[model samples]
Target: MSMRKPLAIFISALMASSAANAAEVYNKDSNKLDFYGKVVGLNYISNNKAEHGDKSYARFGFKGVTKISDQLSGYGQWEYNVKTNNPEAMDMGNATRLAFVGLKFADFGSFDYGRNNGVLYDVSSFTDVNPEFGGDSFTKEDNFMTGRAKGLATFRTSNFFGSIDGLSLALQYQGKNPNPHKSEDRRDGNGEGWGASTSYDLGYGIQLAGAYASSNRTDIQASDKNGQTADAWNLGMKYDNAQLYLAAMYAETRNMSHYGISNNRYAKKTQNIEIAAHYLFVDGPAEGLQPSLAYVQSVGKKLDPVSKSGDAADAAASFKGGKQDLVKYIEVGTSYFFNKNMYTYVDYKINLLKKDTYTSATGVNTDNILGLGLVYQF
Candidate 1:
């Protein structure tokens, strides 16, 4: 077999595990390294001033693998993001997105530790493919074992030890994370937690996935009349071929969702739903064009009632112990790929939130957003 064939296979495997576009830079003595990055010039227009602005950013990462033996291997990855919209003198919003090192045992599984995505994302990610903004249904960064966070030990196995053709399983554990700053929200702090996820590929480009996570809340977080434990679960389904993609997910969280700023409070419960579809035109005049549509909604239930007292901070605080709509929108977009390395996209988010007393008091945004962006990746 030619080296080109194995290199192509390795690249394809990496693409399946990550979304970034990468190119192999070295492959010698059973050791390999790949470099990947993307630069996006993006802008959004919305009636809400906070949401209207430039959103340009650049992200880069590297992946390396060393084969210790035929049955054992070592691998690691590091990725960072830089916000280019900020002035040179100001904070550019630089952050480390992913950093992990792992060991893989052939035909057994892989174990890794470091800051990485939570197991719950295994299911929620099915509907998170919208171009601009559609993954706001409960998965949040730095919020316990939900999206991306720190201090996680994860173990993953594919094909169930080679007995099943399309089954995958993952188990994760998270250590307690103390708030770095005193003023930070208690919701950012978490106690010990664990999560599990499973997925089955049913042939013909169809797959089903589910995940569940539970964690202990910090003392301050549990002091606000909320439960001591935070729990979440998600179920999702997706179908994908070379030309089309479709996905949907439903999730619920208990004592996990938080809202408000100055007088922040946690929602006792939250329900979320998301749906998405995309079609790519290939081998025609419209080749390299893809159109996307999606729907996303999140509602908070059993919220604590707030009294409208004379305090200035309580002026806009009002809840009647009922469910509140956190997010609701329909997104439509299209992307035109100029080639394998470049693409441009336009996305319009039609805000479906209604204006009412609750929305007004809670400061929920009801303005539509239009986003445009150009991207180059290698």
Candidate 2:
């Protein structure tokens, strides 16, 4: 859950260019400054039906804003991701996913500290925006509610339940700073956590969201029976207008902590269900062209062993105990748009792991994915 996402992108494009009529880089009079950024990349191919692979990566970000008046404002951002399949030594600690600096309150609402994004995964952010991976996969996932955490601090709100106008909300916290170069009991995501989310816009396009989160694993020393605490929750629904887009979600997590569970550190309990839809036929010949489909499912059981490695091979993998681990996923994609900066895409995913009877590799991340990408937004 430390994948680092959504830094609320430079305070939502610096509040749409300082609340309108703003394209300044230095507009003297009433004070103004703005700057935005974008750059993304995705390249993929993998068969895993024995073996076949390809990889790619590219990322960059930018943002700047300053408007201290008419309600106050300030912003900053910095992003990175250029590993191109690991160019030998490119760890850069984390390639600085986001630098962070923020404050905005046109009427009250906005704050960011360091690393962000973790309001319980923003209610599944509409199926994780399916541009590539869907919410970072699951099953014992360490996706900690869609990743990103590091002395985090967040808060956001809008219409928070007043003028009825599309209510919104967010809250987050992450702390346990103590990385004197790792190993201080090493439990970055465990020591502290907090989350919250809310959304509403039940009008035409429909939208409703919910989220909740918790964390505390202090390296799991609470007389372990599966770490001390870890929690999650979600509920979502989305519907978009122009061209169509639909989303559905119901998520759950408990104890989680994955990236090789049973490989030990033990944490489990999961359940995920998703539904997705996409469309874009903007009129004529499949206008901008868009097509997408999705269906995801995850289920889990088996977990009971804070001691016992008798026949290790993840000893009866998939959790063990009473056994149960269902997984099914499907994703299809397409996107085309040769204008507006740029656009191009292709995806095909398939993940199935409904097998049991002890197979290990610690629950192989079932696969069958293919992808192509090109996106540009200014």
Candidate 3:
């Protein structure tokens, strides 16, 4: 009788535990998971010295948020490419983009640890369309944080200070991996960086935003040689209405240092300013036809460095370092929306610069591009 009583007690505890576990999963107000991604097809024809690599690709991602309590929760995202040319993939060679997990508290803020966008890229997003697929904008020209691979851990705080009416702040930590080269290159090893930004909405589809970032790393071995600290900063504003949209961004480079090559180190500091605006002409006269026009300009300048170098090579290569004299672009495109989540576009872009230093055609010489593409989002 005594043994049976104990057995009954154990069974009851097991049932209670199982019930609690099931309740958590099917809870009325728990954290939830969402999936999002897109498939992209592109046809790029360059009028310059570059070649067109036409292809189709898709990306898939998952995001989840779970409520731990009334004031705290956990969130994470994992994203990767579904299809791509083997060598065309970016980051980790996995076709995977970002994989990170973090904790979130209502008024305290959030912290994430894993592979993610650098502070400069995060800040850059505030300035322009961030056309990962390719568009002509100033953010696209900066080159420092444009196509970057960074391994990092970061944290962000909520708008406790009310710096802006609706502002939030975040800090990032990026460690530099060293190249087994010279001592000047050694300083680039085990580097660290940080950033800050604020975003606010002024009502009626208008917003203001800004961001900054810096990093130190070993000079990546390349044609141009020199190793020094590298960093960038940017500020931008954006606005949108039913028929028109505008975006502008300004960025500066402290040194000509990136991927380990610091050739223009003492040459000069640089800045890039870009602006783009689009106006809708037609909504949908046909079942799937909407047209728009966009204009983009990318401008740059070199500032005198604090140090003076008498070498003629220093004077010539240091000032322009093979970047570009200037670039301006105009585009007119039509978007056919299948629904709210899918569309196709054909945009013809023209370069208005007189210089031929930068060309898209490698063997040939052209300065224009006609692109046709389709996009599907979820």
Candidate 4:
């Protein structure tokens, strides 16, 4: 069996999902290295003081691959991000976004371990293609196996063991991170967890995907007696072709979605939905321009009533079983690409959630937001 076909497919898929247009820096003796980075000048205008400000950032990463043999290969990637809005003397809020290494066994599958994206992102990513903000229906960072996090072992296979076409599957396991600091947010910590995802291309640029993840909550997280475990599931479909893209997803979570300032409260149950569409002009004066529209909403059910006393016992005692809207907005945007490595975009989020007691007490932002950005990647 030839390794050329499977290896090419794998590499193509990886590049399609990458945020940068990587440039090959080395390709000798079956070892290859690529360098990629992006700089973005961004700002947001909103009624909420916290949300209105400069949001510029700089990100860079490297990817390397080595062909060990006809049936084996090794690969690794590392990415870092730093906020550029602050002064040089202040803390820039730097962080590592991805750092992982893996081995691929030609037509069988690939296994990797380290800080990486959660398996559930496979489905949610379909609708997360807006110019600015869009994936907030039910996905969040450092919230169990729902988004990006630390300590994950992932195994993925494509083409269904080399027999079926356009089919892929993935399985993941996460180690416990017992964040012991009491002052820190507990939502960032989690216990043992596992996840699985699958996707199939039905042909003609249509695809279907689904994923599920479950994890145990830390001791401090469950101290309030809300729930001991967090679980989430998502299903999505998308159509992508030469000139148009459309996607939609529906998701549900139990004891996984966070609320309130510092994410101090957890919702008992939540339901979310997102839909997005974009069209590109391949020719004429509108060439290189794309317009986007999207709708996203998330609702929490059986929420614990908040208390003004700031006492845990009082808040728990006042729980009369409530429900509230967490996020609701419509996004309209457009991006014009000067070339493959640079673009400018403007996105506006039309807030739909009414400003009321529930939203005010929970610190939910109901103000409309306007974002403008210019990006250069290579």
Candidate 5:
């Protein structure tokens, strides 16, 4: 009875039959077309870069809607992500996670344009609940709360002053980027962003989230052109009772800059945290499985310079030399599940280098990471 125990008991009873009922539609008269996809693969290891690897991928999408009359409705999605790592270059060139189009105002909510995801990434994607991997916060720093800002544009709302039960709201923008992001090592540019996010579901399981964003040609330096600015904010909490689940998140990033003379400085200040809990074992032998744990603590500094000083001892003599910072760590293992589109997992991460405070005991442990993966969302 090996072979993953009959494919984990045939994916815990016929995959709980779903895939959104296998979308693929094409209604005639009223006009409708649908299709969707998802796939992720992994097999990796790292004891601070010892290296071991495996990869996989597949992602597809397409959607449609039409009913411009009975109160408006029109939607779309064209997603992309395909690269079998490298089986003789099975690469699919550029990756487009989501292409959008929308207009749905049945109860007053929806407005979209090309290149999706903003709204501070829909409130930090709800702590990014790890399914088979470590939680993600806009890939760590780069996202900085702009949350997938790819020439985006958006607006969403529902349950604002109407009832306020499980309220919702989102707003975003990222105009101007027609090939204006450059890079040498890393200091690309092109941004004129705006963002907002909110969520509430004070139900028995509790929920609350928040977000904030700002941008101005986000550049990581290399002489920040268009003069930097990338603000961010976040908050989170969650508690689910489908057996057990918990969440936490915190974010803060500010990258204000102005070249020389320490003008409006900030140069980058950061803080990020993540936490999670899981427990699901519905039946026997880990029926449908689920054993998860996650934690992330990121702290970065060295640009406060007296909080953008305005003469606080002249910013303490510009730090009188001596400052270095970096920190990130986490341990997450189980993320088991064979339902909700299948699952599997493992992960570990650590990196410590904090020189003038924030103890790491003389620092030594480096970029450690180990990962195991699988995800099958169709």
Candidate 6:
């Protein structure tokens, strides 16, 4: 062909190739990475008005998955809190929560390590539908359950026995650093513990799950007893649909000591049972609303009264109270979700049925609490 003809054909081909390349980039972007974050702020009133305050937190996160091959791929997630506010008071800048890194192996399992909520807290969250505020709501996550340890690690399975589809198992390991200054700090750098849990979806929007975990600490002290240890476990079930959800959970804690002459001496136990329900509605199809309610009852038997005492020794002295059947709490809470990412909540709790109080080592009933707040999550 003539040189001029060849040059014209080349220019046309180049234009067509550019258009094709643009189309390919748009289509292949399905595998591209992404990032997301949220900031939540709210003000609330408490039973003791003096305890009322504002709550705000900033969350930043990143997630991505790359397909290495047909049956193999890589996935990861990193999330950190940019802001932590004081709900007990009008203070800002507290501590970052839930910062972790996870790796996934398709069809195999996944491993995650770093600062993450404990398995106990995870189970509690799975059951609670109501929003939480400061120390008033059970869904706020008790210190013993939500606190993160430094040497924490978790592993989860992709599936179970090739059947029971959508079923997975999670194993967790946490190292504790017991600080003499902290009252409930169970993270002992020397003491460590591990646990495993199994969960499965039954299809049709329903799920069943259960988990058992036990941790032992060497420097643990109870009453006047040193080398004290505790074991915990949780069981739960859930049902869900486009309209409603029902969840129930049971958890227990048992204490043991090695110094005591009596085999079961210095041994104490605490049990918690909770139930929750959530309902969803479409006001006009364009807008939606979700409402939820939950109740929790905690009972203790032969519980060491020392738990409430700031002094470990004092708490230990109150450990064995007049009646082993002492100490209990009943709580109820509700929340309304205006949308998937924003909501408001209210909660009431009674620390009734106490065999002893901090003032009376023998036993005493405590005060009640009421709380209301709002939250937004992304």
Candidate No. with top TM-score? 4
TM match of model 1 to true structure: 0.92
Shift of residue 201 alpha carbon in model 5, Å: 40
Among residues 3 or more apart in sequence or in different chains, the pairs in candidate 2 whose N, CA or C atoms overlap within 3 Å are 1-142, 1-143, 1-144, 1-147, 4-148
**Candidate 3 lDDT tens digits, 1-378:** 122333223322321221111112223468677766677887778744344566567777777788999988998877777545335445333455677899887777788887666556554553343222223333322233432344566777655443445565667776655543465442223345555655666777676666676665444422223334556676767666534556666766654322112322221345556665544333234544545554544443442221123242443323323444344666666666555456688877765655332221111123677778888666
Question: What's the residue-level lDDT of 358 in candidate 6?
Answer: 35
Q: What is the lDDT of residue 310 in candidate 4?
A: 52
Q: How far is 98's C-alpha from truth in model 4 (Å)? A: 0.5
Return the top candidate by lDDT: 4
Candidate 6 TM-score, C-alpha based? 0.69
lDDT of each candidate versus the true structure: 0.83, 0.60, 0.52, 0.84, 0.59, 0.52
Better of 4 and 5 by TM-score: 4
Q: Which stretches of candidate 1 lie over 4 Å from their true place?
A: 1-20, 261-263, 306-317
Q: What lDDT tens digits, residue by residue, belong to model 5 across residues 53-95? A: 6656677777788888887889877777776666664555437
Model 6 regions more than 4 Å off: 1-33, 47-50, 66-72, 82-93, 133-149, 176-190, 220-228, 256-267, 283-287, 305-338, 345-377
Per-candidate count of clashing residue pairs (backbone under 3 Å)? 0, 5, 18, 0, 0, 14
Question: Please, what is the TM-score per model?
Answer: 0.92, 0.30, 0.69, 0.92, 0.32, 0.69
lDDT measured at residue 327 in model 6 versus the true structure, 0 to 100: 34
Candidate 2 residue lDDT tens string, 195-242: 888888888878888888877765532334565777778788887764
Instruction: Indicate whether candidate 1 or candidate 2 has the larger lDDT.
Output: 1
- Tens-digit lDDT track for model 1 on 1-378? 222333333322332455446889999999999999999999999989978999999989989999999999999988899999999998757989889999999978999999899999999888887678787778887788789899999999999977898999999999999866474457578899999999999999899999999999888788877779999999999987745778999999998777653335677899999999877666557766778999999898987665345233464555555787878899999987776678899999999988764565566678999999998888
Per-candidate RMSD, Å: 3.9, 19.4, 13.6, 5.1, 19.1, 13.3
User: 138 in model 1: Cα distance from truth in Å?
Assistant: 0.6
Q: Which segments of candidate 4 are over 4 A away from where they belong?
A: 1-16, 180-184, 308-321
Error of 3 at 71 (Å): 1.7
